[model samples]
Target: MTEEDSLRETRMPSLRIMAKNTRDVMKEPILQSILEKSILTKTQLETLLIDLVIEDEFENHISYKEKASLRSKAASRSRGVSRGAFNRTLNQARKNITRCFYTMLLLAYLGLFEFTFFSPFEELATRIEGYRRIRDTLAGKTDLSSEEIESYQSAERTILSALDSLSTSLSLKSRLSRRKTGSEIESER
Candidate 1:
């Protein structure tokens, strides 16, 4: 086998493990709802994740063509697109991420981010981070009592419900309803 083929063969197991873990995370109801409501599509998120894995996980840096192939395999896509398409999706994901940051900056600049209104968003972020840590902790434990398992499950369910509710509340429709209209502001002035 060629050197590149041998390298790919060695990487397959790690790639598959990553893909399975990513799939499991994406299957969470809260994550599914958030993805559905977010600017990035699954393909775009998958593309970005694959790109990061390829870049950060390997000893040797890979080319765009190889990255594209790896992305297709990781996603289990039957009909994989070309490198160009993968690059396009990666760019789109990056653009969406940048736009989100800019939007937050604009909100801060306008002095529109009141603690009363934005605290929930911050809390949601903290909860999501904590949930990830909890999952990681649970996954690392090879042996656990039934009670412990049950406790983890209960916590997961409670967090999922809270996450879903927080996501729903942060939706555009909900935000718009809570905001004052231009006319309302003018009338107040």
Candidate 2:
């Protein structure tokens, strides 16, 4: 087998594991709660996830192609889709997934932040402004001040840290539950 083929074989399992972890993370209650409070429905979230996964696969495939020798590339071209078409699809998918994820994160952050304030209108306005800033920043239409950027980055970091801790706990619980079930089955056998 070619070195590129061997590398791709080794990479597949890691990609599978990452996909599984992403699936597990999406099923998490915290994520569900956030989604409930967001503009996106469960179906929309699933669609975004699907797009993200497909984009990731396409990017990985492109990377593999970039690393392969000219002969291998020529051989693969006969079996592969047009690179230009693939790239356009990948870019579209990436944009969709990114927009959805950013919106979800902003909504979740606003939801969490709203609870600390007493006035509903004030919180609503805050959310609207935050979303505007996010949209503008993402579109490259406006530059964020240092303070604004720092606050946004801090919120993102805090949310990610919380999710990481929750994921770790959930993983441990799943592993322990599986072990318990295995032991019970062994005892019965």
Candidate 3:
């Protein structure tokens, strides 16, 4: 093959398997099979595993029944899916559920706080036709009436306050692991 063709064919290795200065005794064939089948990406697979702990602890809540059903459906569909692909889909579904759960909590908090759904800016935008009316009205002018100026300011305040309250909702870091659980873990069957 030409050098260009060879270069084009090169692929990056998955980061999870990379190790430095040492090697483990086990190859983890089951995980390898999952990867080969496209059950999930390494990152997403890790998330699902981590979140599974949290999700399991939450089984007493409302969604355990629904998710169990969904998992059954996913199991049926995943029969044809490779490990990586199945992992990707499962991770996305998990992220969606996680997001929805947290979002509902945030919304409930906002409701308790009696926060306005539409801030002054949004109200103004509606009244002004989505900023167009204000833009056209003030295109040639530098000053604004009190009501006219409050719209944008109100929106900014609402968004800032909402974000400030939701700041706790965002978490980006995660702990990594080789084995998903303790050695006692076994097949469901």
Candidate 4:
């Protein structure tokens, strides 16, 4: 053999020795614990991993009759228990339907109120515009005289004051209602 070929063959033995030494060093710490916990040989572990792969690939499982038997057993149990459960389910469904209908009515009422009566800014704008137009109409009048103008002004002031009082009372009522509702929910919880 050539000198280079002999040297290469000589190096392979030491290389194998080094690799085996490294493997033993790495496995030494874990070996005792694994041996204590499991009775499987290396071959048995390999076989089990192979079987799991095969099962996943092939979709192999219990017999169809066994599955049908389990399903029937489950159905029988449900039938036994559902005899008493039907009435409660029916009653709860009826109650839910009633509550849904009532909610619809309440929403309709709220929508109507919103459309007809809840335009605060528009109402205030219209009322103020009416007062302004009346004042403008009475401004250049010489036939009204001083006494009639004074009386009309007094009446306008009274009506405006009453409207302001009504707005304040409505605001307070809304605030108090919200506070009461919060307290009631807190008490219930």
Clashes of each: 0, 0, 18, 0
Candidate 2 positional error at 40, Å: 5.3
Q: Please say which candidate is ahead in TM-score: 2 or 4.
A: 2
Of models 1 and 4, which has the larger lDDT?
1
For model 2 the local lDDT of residue 175 reads 48
Best by lDDT: 1
Predictions: Cα RMSD each: 5.6, 17.0, 22.9, 36.2
Cα-based lDDT for every prediction: 0.73, 0.51, 0.41, 0.45
True-vs-predicted CA distance for residue 132, candidate 2, Å: 26
TM-score of 4: 0.24
Cα lDDT of model 3 by residue, 16-92, tens digit: 12211001211233234324434344434533542354344433331322222222123243212344554556668
Summarize candidate 4's per-residue lDDT along 78-119 as a digit string, tens digits. 211232233333345456557767875896777743552335
Every model's TM-score = 0.75, 0.29, 0.21, 0.24
* Candidate 2 per-residue C-alpha lDDT over 1-189 given as tens digits, one digit per residue, 9 for 90 to 100: 999778877775565455455556567554664565555645445434534563475465525232211111123333233445334444565666689788758867777434422243354346546644664575573767787777666655555454444443333344467578779899999
Evaluation by lDDT, superior candidate among 2 and 3: 2
Which 10-residue window of candidate 3 scores lowest in summed lDDT?
Answer: 14-23
Flag regions of model 2 displaced more than 4 Å: 36-189
By TM-score: ranked, best first: 1, 2, 4, 3
Candidate order (lDDT): 1, 2, 4, 3
After superposition, the stretches of candidate 1 with alpha carbons farther than 4 Å from their true spots are 72-79, 167-189
